[model samples]
Target: MDSASVPFAALDYIIFGVYLFIIIGLGLWVSREKEGRQKDSSDYFLASKSLPFWAIGSSLIASNISAEQFIGMSGSGFRVGLAIASYEWMAAVTLLVIAYFFLPIYLEKEIFTMPQFLEQRYDGRVRMLLAIFWLLVYVFVNLTSVLYMGGLSMNIIMGLPLWGSIAGLALFATAYSLYGGLKAVAWTDVVQVVVLVGGGLLTTWVALDAYGGSSTGPVGGLTQLMGDASNRFNMILFEGELMYQNDEGVTQDAYQLLPGLSVLFGGLWVANLFYWGCNQYIIQRALAAKNLQEAKRGLAFAAYLKLLLPLIVVVPGIVAFALDAPIQRGDEAYPWLLGQYVGTGFRGLAFAALVAAIVSSLASMMNSASTIFTMDLYRNYVEEEVSESKLVRIGRIVALACIVVATLVAPQLADLDQVFQYIQEYTGFVSPGVLAIFVMGLFWSKATPNAALVSAVLSIPLSAAFKFLTPEIAFLNRMLIVFFVSVALIVGISYVENRGETHPKAIDLDDVEHDSDPIFQVAAFGILGITAALYVIFW
Candidate 1:
């Protein structure tokens, strides 16, 4: 390794070791089975349906924020600036929508996985097909990308070999999670979130203080950064507004990434909704909640966390940019900040926090991917009457298998510049179809099994078509086109096939309650108000 690389000092390793001990112990402590009972699918996959609002809230953010946010999004902040935070800010509003609209519907169905919901709304064929698609994407796209990005950060700051770091992260996540399942993943996440947030703010504060350059403290750093990097503070990117260097060091229009007002009005919603509501690992925490109210409250808590995330994830990247950080790539920005700015005594604690983010997310995805595979595919098709204990065993096995596969695949992502944007673009290929099927099934009574099935099948190819055929169209815009087309196809086919009649399998939207107490109302409105104010200020 080059002398320029700042390897973790002895104090740093000691802090990280303590963090691992506490988290692993916590995960194992809660995962212990009740005195005489053997493990069941609910216990293994859904945390015994015993999670409270606080645990759910913490796990949702833990699962959602990871190398993707800390490393990849920070890299985005370095490349295109605060416009990348559109993902974070818009997600706060989307969480409320998910809480109000989506959570109740899923809870009422009493389902274990998203694929099972598909079976109830459509058919077994749809369920099986989508289950396979979800597994492939979770392992190949989501899980591997996180591992690659997390390793990239570790390599930069800790002076570890990239492949070894990827393997180490996989092993660390597997240690606590394989034995305990969702119960372990979720409860440990409560602790993980604390470490993750504390560590992030410390990093941001120090970086900002350094950026201030003796003018004042962190506040001065902020004022100076704002004044000097005025262009980096923009929330929207119109055509010809700005050009910035990507990971490859190629300058490009920021509009290609942010895509202007579409962030508020168009396909970004499709991505956020699918991620927050429809995606398995993310929503699995909500599924584990004790009741709908608890889940809603958990989502509310997460919404507030989302509002504050840019400070931790984005601001440091901007600080790095204003400082003209000498990094090899965009994803290296956060690690560079750590090596260059973060102090010795605290570096271990900060590094621990980053590890907390990575492993918590890794554990969550492995659990969810296994849930879909074992429940939807294995239990249903492989062995129809498998014992509950056996099902739990299968889940553990599948989770291990998925992690193993991801460990093998993650290193290949080294070529991508801005792994966060890469994940969004590629995941968009599948999101349009996933969103269309769920939205139509939930709200429209006439949506046919055939229509939903066709839309699900076409989501990716159509996205790829728009991507290759019309390269000039920004990906966010392409996703909008694919979504509209999917919706239109669903409508036309449903009307033609079902002859304007309600499908028998349609969710009774009226029966799915929208009732919320005053507390939920205040929280929801608070989220909306904050979101609006942010846009007004940032715009």
Candidate 2:
């Protein structure tokens, strides 16, 4: 499909314009002064730690479900079917665990960033190392990928040029986030999530409506879609089962990337735990919550939202396949469907949703990168006596710089076959070791700082070597191997270093009480149950 050939009508343009107006107004309004009071770093970076559960939850979803999920995951759905939803479904459970097990510690410590938590647990060296690493990833990897995908979608569906789309998105996100920071990002995210989910569902419904030929009714269309694409509905794919024939005319295995049951019990956990529990951008909303209960409740809400994501993001791709939508690449599935099925007025809303996903993620990443730079590095080391006002200024400067770098780098990602999978595969190398360090740091008293440091240093090279030497091993399995090896290294080094010596009191774990929110507990159980049912039904 030549995306340039599709034209949007006036109503679509009006709707899109109105959406932009309302969101910008809402963001500015929400972050505006109450009786002329000024916002400090606490307000700018952490929303003054006053966000409710709903705001926190909505922000989490908005930050997590970006153009990557819409374009990348949907593309995966087009090629690999329902199995790709494990990322979404499994994340629900991961969010629950983070809520119950992780939030208490973070909240008790009153920490602003993930690296701060590491510094509290280990040393400033670990804090400084991870902070710099996270800053680089947020700017180069996370921000760059989101910008590229968002630009690609806009170029395809809205007829905008790629560079123009990238610049527009960067400016749009920076417009609000630079001044209002997390307060603006979190509040605006509530609106973005509504639009994103609504537009996504609208696209899915319209695609399903057009699933069968003209002779078929809506129900018949659905039935025919399922009947024709039944092979694509499985949640657990076995090795060697042919998934899809690519443009190159080569058939790929159903479980080639996911590696079947390993998604359920293996390295997937490492990825999820690292992402949901440790990643700064994703967890920042929770960290900014008013209390541990609110954070837990917020996470529970995100968990429920995660359960519904596949319906909006994944189902449309499957529908596209069922209808044999004339798309050039699997990543074009969502945009192609928009060009075909969505009408004028709703087309703008759909476009707004895509823009919202892109902008929200961009804002979140910028804010987090700022947080790490300003709070972790600048305040602690560069200028310890900096005023809150000066720190906020520094944050804005750092955020803008990061955005500029990301925008410049985004276009380079155009050559990738699937930007989403590329992100996962590359990030997997470090996530395992990071997860191992956090797990041991939190639970194992014998885990020495030197051991954690060694594991962190060696984990990436080990993963790279494994990737090069044993290219046939699935990436997920490689993550599993790296995670265990990292754990072993941590354990062995800790034992040898601490041999015949009394354990240091400095390494004692934080004694934070669990958030005993009944609502959170019930919601967690309910989400887990639903996740289990989804796998059982779809498997």
Candidate 3:
């Protein structure tokens, strides 16, 4: 390695040191308020439903924007083109739907963990199965991915060994999550989101400035750099290619919606609804809001935040590609871009921001996992009589234990070339089943516990077949096919098993109100309008 390329310097370390201190301090500050409370399951799990909309919204954004976006999504942008940005842009609509269509049911019911809703709709067995599945998925896919990539990003930025970075992240996450729970994660995330977005925009601006200042001069310079003349067909055509993957750095188009129709329709929609609407790690913050109005406001805030995410996470990636930086691996772009454009004091702050993003994600996942374990799994199955204080104590222990296990697994994450792909591949195992069961439970009264269990059981093998048997089929297409098949299986079997007798309780949608903030509606429309304008421009 070159002398300049050592993983970190005193400056980088100092920045990270300050970041760690502030985050831990925030955790301690949030913990102070809970010092003498009853420390019940509700308090340990949902922060006693006392958070404001801004804090919940910021925490949601921070939890979602991990090293995966900074490292993986940006790297994908470098390899392919702007097409990879759909993940960010499309989520705006998803969040809007969640805010208006989904959050009401959850907030109205006052559910602690989402799996609890499954029990209310189905049975204890379904709830237990889902809780276990979600718990494992969080630890293996979400938690591990966050820590593994966070460590890798730090190593690349600082010129340190990967293990050192992993240890550092683990220690920081453990301190915040174990000591403070959701309260700590939420407040620290507020600071984390600001730093991360600022750092990302700074990187993107530097990249664009570099591209625009070339000898060719601004417009000519940017166009020539961004275009691949030899791949005319790729540039004009969009559907056939996965927007996020470029076989060899080709400038594939993002204009056509046909290729990813499934993702645009049900596949991506299902994932987003499941993720933002019902998932523990993402929605736990929303559930911690002081009231239904606050929860709705928080979700609207997150929706607005989602609309702006592409500016921070996706645009820099496009810049990376425009600069002709090597992005054979999607996880390499952010570090490569940061290493190229950043220097000195700013580098320290940017590095600190990246660290904060990773820690925020880790803390979110760890806290959520602890919640599911303590409230859904342990309280229901293992220890039914623990007091509130003891429950909190158990949650702290569970959080630390999960961190240790995930850290050990972090080193093995190196072989997973594309972090986002790895996340989807593993998550697909359970996401489809979970999504199916949740949708049915919420909207279909006739859906039985047996049907939920059977659909979940059958969806796994069907998903695996799509993964291994038809390897050439796009992942999004496979998800759509799996979703329909699972739906068919569940509905068909339920009809037959019930002998044409449907459950008599009708879902009361009349009680659901349409009271979303006007600002959010405007922002949602603006996102759609911008997407349409982009399509027109490219066409």
lDDT of each: 0.91, 0.86, 0.73
**Model 2 stretches with alpha carbons more than 4 Å out:** 1-5, 34-36, 213-220, 246-250, 500-510
Please give the range of 10 consecutive residues that has the lowest summed lDDT in model 1: 1-10
Model 3, residue 110: C-alpha shift (Å): 1.3
In order of appearance, the predictions have TM-scores of 0.99, 0.96, 0.90
On TM-score, the stronger of 2 and 3 is 2
Model 1 earns a TM-score of 0.99
- Model 1's C-alpha root-mean-square deviation from the true structure amounts to 1.0
> Residues 1-539, candidate 1, lDDT per residue (tens digit)?
73336877788888899999999899989889879988899999999999999999999999999999999999999988898999999999999989998999999998999999999998898898899999999999999999999998888887889999999999999999999999999999999999999999999999988888766999999998989998989898899798987766688998988889999998899999999989999998888899998999999999999999999999998988888888778888898898888888689888888899999999999999999999999988889999998998999899999999999999999988889998999999999888999998888889988898999999989999999999888898888889889999999999999899988998888888766668888988999999999999889
- Best-first order by TM-score: 1, 2, 3
lDDT score for residue 506 of model 1:
87
> What is the C-alpha lDDT profile of model 3 across 238-345, one tens digit per residue?
454444344455544333222444545656665666677778999888789987667766766776676667656666666666566654556766787777777666
Error of 1 at 344 (Å): 1.6
Question: Residues 126-208, candidate 2, lDDT per residue (tens digit)?
Answer: 78888887888888889999999998998888678889989999999988778899999999999999999999888877777
Cα-based lDDT at residue 485, candidate 3: 78
Candidate 2 vs candidate 3, lDDT winner: 2
